[model samples]
Target: MKILKLEIKQKPFDDILSGKKYFERREIKPSNVIDYVSFIVDGKEYEKEEDVPEGDSEVMVKAKSYDRLKLVTGEYKGKRPYLMVEVKDAHVEFLYDENGDFIVGVEKGKEYAIAHIVFELGNVVEIFKGEK
Candidate 1:
């Protein structure tokens, strides 16, 4: 199973840990065009729309199958606090401008959205406080 590690802030982390947040969303950066907005799994990059595997999820961007999401409190270290949780689903959404219209463009190649990434939250596998 592919495990995606992400450094998250405190409030959101707490919400996820407490079962308040059901999914996590990441805004696509301007620096990364649609083609570049992707996830690297096992040395392979899932960048294209057809590349990410979808399991019957109705999302603008098909959800990639990630087994676990390793969330870190801050910079990842040898013994830092981390939360490993089962990833129920993952997907990407398009970007909308101030007018609410869909914002699409070509950068290096054809692409979609500003890149809204959605990773559905699942059961918590492990939570390490990082205290030694």
Candidate 2:
């Protein structure tokens, strides 16, 4: 089977990050905005390679001109806050094996900042950028 991919357009972090601040007011919708995962700590660079926590919180994912997708939040025993992205498919193969257990591997791919969302630009090949 062929793999589905997405692409994130190049834009400044301010433009992308601004979309999240108003997701609940129905000001955002899914269209073609870039998706990324990121966190702010002590005014320093916090990479997604770190672990996240488990919780019933919402993670806002905004596209440049699309509706923002609210995602489920999770946590880990280690440092850093973790956010989960909503995937359209249930591809079990995309998951990761953490010490003999299966876990949603959102950060398994490349690392890029799309619309303030932290993700690898390479993993998102066709979905956002479209197929060739």
Candidate 3:
């Protein structure tokens, strides 16, 4: 399955392990934001090969987003905690400014720093005891 590996911290990790946290948040950065699995804009083809089309619009990321999410935490009690969760669905939200509007920056009419991808976590399929 397609897995998205993420490094998590202690506090949140404990919450997730205890089933207190239900969702995981990750910002859409260049290193992670690549070609879309399948997304359209304004009822038109948004070009899957391209990152995003020019205009003020939003699209839902699907399929290739990831079938599973791998969360890893650094050394804790001489062991790194690692958890693999099934990603049921993912939601994408465009960032806004102080005025609470979508921030579509300049660089070829793209928004690199203005989007958030939240993973709706499902069951914890696997848990691995990481090395110290």
Over 4 Å off in model 2, which ranges? 1-35, 49-132
Query: Model 1, which residues run further than 4 Å from truth?
Result: 30-61, 75-78, 98-100, 104-112
* Local distance difference test, each candidate: 0.71, 0.27, 0.71
lDDT of 3 by residue, 1-132 (tens): 788888899788778878899888876654456532346676654435365677688755543468888898886567677898988888777788999877764455544546667788888988876765
2 against 3, candidate with superior TM-score: 3
lDDT score of residue 124 within candidate 2? 16
Candidate 3: worst 10 consecutive residues by lDDT?
Answer: 29-38
Residues 1-132, model 1: lDDT tens digits = 788777889889889999998787776554433422454444456665456565654333344567898888855556778899998877777778899988876556756455577888899999988864
Separately for all candidates shown, the number of backbone clashes (residues 3 or more apart, or on different chains) is 3, 28, 0
TM-score of each: 0.64, 0.17, 0.68
Q: Hey, what RMSD does candidate 1 come out at?
A: 7.7
lDDT (C-alpha) at residue 69 in model 3:
83
Per-residue lDDT over 15-65 for candidate 2, one digit per residue giving the tens place of the 0 to 100 score: 233343221111111221212323334343333424333455443322222
Which candidate leads the pack in TM-score? 3
How should the candidates be ordered by TM-score, best one leading?
3, 1, 2
Clashing residue pairs in candidate 1, if any?
63-90, 95-113, 95-114
**Model 1: ten consecutive residues of lowest lDDT:** 30-39
